[model samples]
Target: MYKTKRTVFIFLILLISLIVLTACNKASSSSGDEETSKEDTKEASTEPVELTIAARAGSMADALTEVVKQYEEETGNKVNVNAMPYDNLKETVVLDVRNNSGAFDLVMIDDPWMPEFAEGELLTNLDSYFPDGLASDFVQKSAALGKVPYETGSTYAVPFIGNVQMFFYRNDLVEKYDIDAPQTWDDVLAFAETIKDEEQETFGYALRGQRGNPIVSNYLPLFWAYGGTVLDENMKPQVNTEAGVKAMEMYMKLKETGPKGVETFDSDQIATSLTQGQVAMTIAWPSWVSEVDNKENSNVVGKVNFSAVPSQESDAAAMIGNWLLGIPRTSQNTDAAAAFLEWVTSAETQKEMTILGAGAPTRVSVYEDPELVEQYRHFPAQLEALQNSVARPRTSKWSQVEDTWGMYLSQILAGQLDIQEGLDKANEELEGILAK
Candidate 1:
């Protein structure tokens, strides 16, 4: 009996030892599998790459930064943004690309610079990447500006900002005076006069009479709508034509109704005047439209109404001033940069961007998105204006032309030079530029 009991105890001890060893092996296998799965996930989600972007400063810069944050969070890629001043961005990017400094993998370019960059083969031709062509939802006018040949050619850039000039007015004041919305420049002048006389205001209009780009851009719509042309079909200067004289005369006439110290007003000042409800009507851009509804920045919330720019003998033509994103030919991270470019310009991202009130949409779908249109009352008009817009002349020399021409326009506006004299001088200088 003692030997049998000892044998049974040994059997029980052996059985207990086997069970413990099996359980330990199972636990170890499970943990190994879990670790392997985690490793796979980490490899899948993170690219372990870094990208640099040259972006413009101000609200546009902030907006791009927000987009980059979303990209980094999803992909675990390191992104460095270089936000340069608007005045310096072009020259800086040009130098970086010309020297292949590799400082910027991606760069934001103004539409006017597209020709120069394309001519020099400084940017990647996205045609191979977008073999099916760009998304159809992009505004045709805005997208066309991204092509090397203006309306057609290989796509080198993507329009990031859907900007076109717009007409802004105080709806309450329009109603108070019982005036119909102006359809022509003549009507605009008349409206300005009525507002000045009936309201006993010092200025009924807000004009950006500052020298250089600000004043030139503000005057072009009027110049175009009055059947004037800065250059003829032959690319020769035509600013001294009868229509040109008339347009400048009308511009001067409108200036007569603007505030004192108008010569110094830039976009910011024009925006401020309208936001404060101090101006009756102003020619504006999508960049300024966002401010009218912000309680923090504007006193004219819900009081300002927008329309396509007014016309005269010719149809209304808003000027396209879009920002574009392009990859440098020398970029080492072309694949990553292209991915980011495609991602940010997607309709989904653009809609998300609008929700954040970043910038205007380049996608028609975003523009017509019912929620967006309801929230931004100017969207329909903005879309119409974008469709009817004209781009600056597709010339590599546009910057120089604008400089010479805008200087003369400013001189005329400041009363330092005669209108005819300035026009003739601008025409001669432009001819000389085109000759080259």
Candidate 2:
């Protein structure tokens, strides 16, 4: 009986030992599998992706190139940048999309072209990529411009440049005239008149009145401030209304104090005139802010200050012309492109980009960052203008409309057509164009 009891005890011990050994083996295998899986994921994420981007050429593009360099280093990715003139960007991207050629993984777009791209289904729905929706750091108007329906549609892009027309003037000039900063259209006109009369060497204003987009973009702020709109609520032509006539007259009056050959001044000429200290004041974009302060490019360094467009019967309103970044639907590496997009537009990245002289920050927080504010004094006013700015009419046909209206407006500016007659003719032509 003692021997049988001992045997039973040994048998039970052996069974327990076997169970322990199996459990150890299973745990070891599981741990090995987990480690291998993690390593695989790491390898996949670190795999090199060659991303291509289409961007506008200039300092803005230079800024992006710098950001791309930082991104490549951080992620071990390769990037190819294609920077072209602004005039060619739309056509190039559109061709790539229409042909379903995945030549570019990302494209920087002007806000006005969002409608056409969205309508054509050329861009991916970026809203789905961000599980919680876009970060709320962006200014409302600037953010809205990236949506397909302006305020309501799914987001197809993110605002890459915080662009709004800002009213810039020489602070020293204003102080010298003993005039408080112009707060209204009347104030702006008065300042311009005083400067033109007193400062013989300096033109009072510098505005872009060149044919086509240049003249139209510069004029629209004044048009809206005077309660003039290109179209009424029903989308009918209203450019010949009383408000339109008044806005045009005010614009011409302001232009009278500008340089000789004002009718030929485009954005480049306007920016040069302002930085050269040949003009006392101008309504301009933040893209020129750096040039205005650079000692090499500007004679008015440390003297220029920016404000919102001057108010009139209506409160001040700026024209928002933000550029956006988007992924094309034909892109094979949407994930990689999206990663770059999110990284570039983040508040932290934007602050860095601002320091690098890229486009203006699209984030309100970036604009408000203490260090950034110190470096860019106009940031506060720029944020204010961006928040209050209005978009051009949200029509797919705006390009055609602008071409037609701009031609007539240019004719009027050159004394080739009377203001009222020119406006009536433009209204008629725009109606026909929109109808088609």
Q: Which prediction has the highest lDDT against the true structure?
A: 2
Give Cα-based local distance difference scores for all models: 0.87, 0.88
lDDT of 1 at 226: 81
Candidate 2, residue 427: how far the Cα is off, in Å: 0.7
User: Per-residue alpha-carbon lDDT of model 1 for 31-146, expressed as tens digits?
Assistant: 99999999997886455678898988877777777777888988878788899898899888888889989888889998989989988888999998888878999999988988
Q: Write the per-residue lDDT of candidate 2 for residues 1-436, one digit (tens) a residue.
A: 9999999999999999999999999999999999999999998877899999999998778888888888899988888889999999999999998999999999999898888888898999988787676888888788888787778878889988888999999899988878799888788888888889999789888778887898889888888898888877778888898878888888888888889898888888988899899998888998788899999879999999999988898888999988899999999999999998999899988888888887588999999999889988899999999988999888878999988888888888888999999999999999998788
Once superposed on the true structure, which residue ranges of model 1 sit more than 4 Å away at CA?
1-47
What lDDT score goes with residue 110 in model 2? 89
Error (Å) of candidate 2 at residue 257 is 1.8
Supply every candidate's count of residue pairs whose N, Cα or C atoms clash at under 3 angstroms: 0, 0
